[model samples]
Target: MNSALVRVPGTGEVSLAPADTPEPADPIAPLAAPWVGLGLSTPDGTTLARKVEKEGTEHWQQLTPARYIYKSQELTVASVFQETKGEVLSAYFGGMKFAAVGTSTPKVYRAEISSIPKGDVRALCVDWIDTVSDTEVYHHRLYLPRAEVSETEDAQWGRSQEARWGMKFSALAPPKGKTYIAVWLTDDPAVLFGAPAVTTGALDVITEDQPRGK
Candidate 1:
């Protein structure tokens, strides 16, 4: 017993501890924008997409319930993005035919994308992922949803900019429900996928593995 040795309790396997092992990275290390990306949960509930932008969610209330006044409030999740197209986008937006002469109702549009045909009310979720670290991610799931789209194109005839769309959605809690927004944060991808944990190390456990800032 001259030297320190570690052994498994049940198997009785003795192992030597290495002195040169590097320290684990900081799990709560700060992150930056260049290596971050946004993802939206797909319709099939199987995967994610990079269609979403870094634009954050907006939550506000005009009056506090404690104050007891006529107050206006809305809990909404919005995604601003340059116009893009795909099966997911087409299905979600209801056939991808953007026109000013539309007479259909919002309920009709939502039904087109919703896997569950809950007319007038839908459910959606978004994922905020860190590309630099590939470790941490934020997932937001909302209930009882409604969607609105606003797009603008600036035509100066000289200066040009790409048209952008703002997807405004409001979510509400259902009856007997106390939660409106559920957020999940984790460094492991398997956890996000609802699978068992199976990874480790500085990249997985600690640091985001990003470059330093100026």
Candidate 2:
């Protein structure tokens, strides 16, 4: 197993935990912060030996949970406007391209922040709104981060939501839970195809601290 220590940027550093160390109370806390976007092309199961190409990393975190929170914040902001990095937000795995903003609970330029850090640990973990439709604009599937909401909501054009992982809707391509967030919308397919998308981009590297998509 690949093991190493990653430091938190803004927050104070914590000792590196053993490989797959179980920290039941750190979902909302930044533990294993990921280095900015570092691209690596590695085969499956050989993630430990993956390389790093140093691409533009939109988000960073100390541990896996922290990474999610940080990325979510950035994604939340990106949804409101198209000006974050101005990187021409590409579609994630043939999905929509959204402008990003903010560094906390961010969203695509087209969408608003739906997910939020849950759990009593402050930053131990984060989840999306159950419905993805705005509570105010029920038509758009505000941020309801649970399975029950997605199962019963009336999905509309260019909008979809899932409350739990492994329970994605057929119309939407987003995976369940906190896994790969395959985008749901974008203006150009070619541009979306330019790179592998945000989640994939993060997984491209083996030593990226993130092991999910590797």
- Of the candidates shown, which would achieve the greatest TM-score relative to the real structure? 1
Off by over 4 Å in 2: 1-25, 35-83, 86-214
lDDT by residue (tens digit), candidate 1, 1-214: 1011111112110001111112113223332222112233222322212132233334375433333333344455554444343323432353343333446655233223444433233334333333323442332222122322222223232346544333444433333433333233335344333333223443332223434456
Best by lDDT: 1
TM-score of 2: 0.14
Models, CA RMSD each: 19.8, 24.0
The lDDT values for all models are 0.31, 0.22
Tell me the TM-score of model 1: 0.31
TM per prediction = 0.31, 0.14
Tens digits of per-residue lDDT, candidate 2, 1-214, equal 1111111122111111112223223223233442111111111100011122333334365333422222221122111111222111111111223556666574534643235522110011111111222431111011111111012112223435322111111112223444422122212222232222233333433443445652
- Clashes (backbone N, CA, C under 3 Å), per candidate, total 0, 60
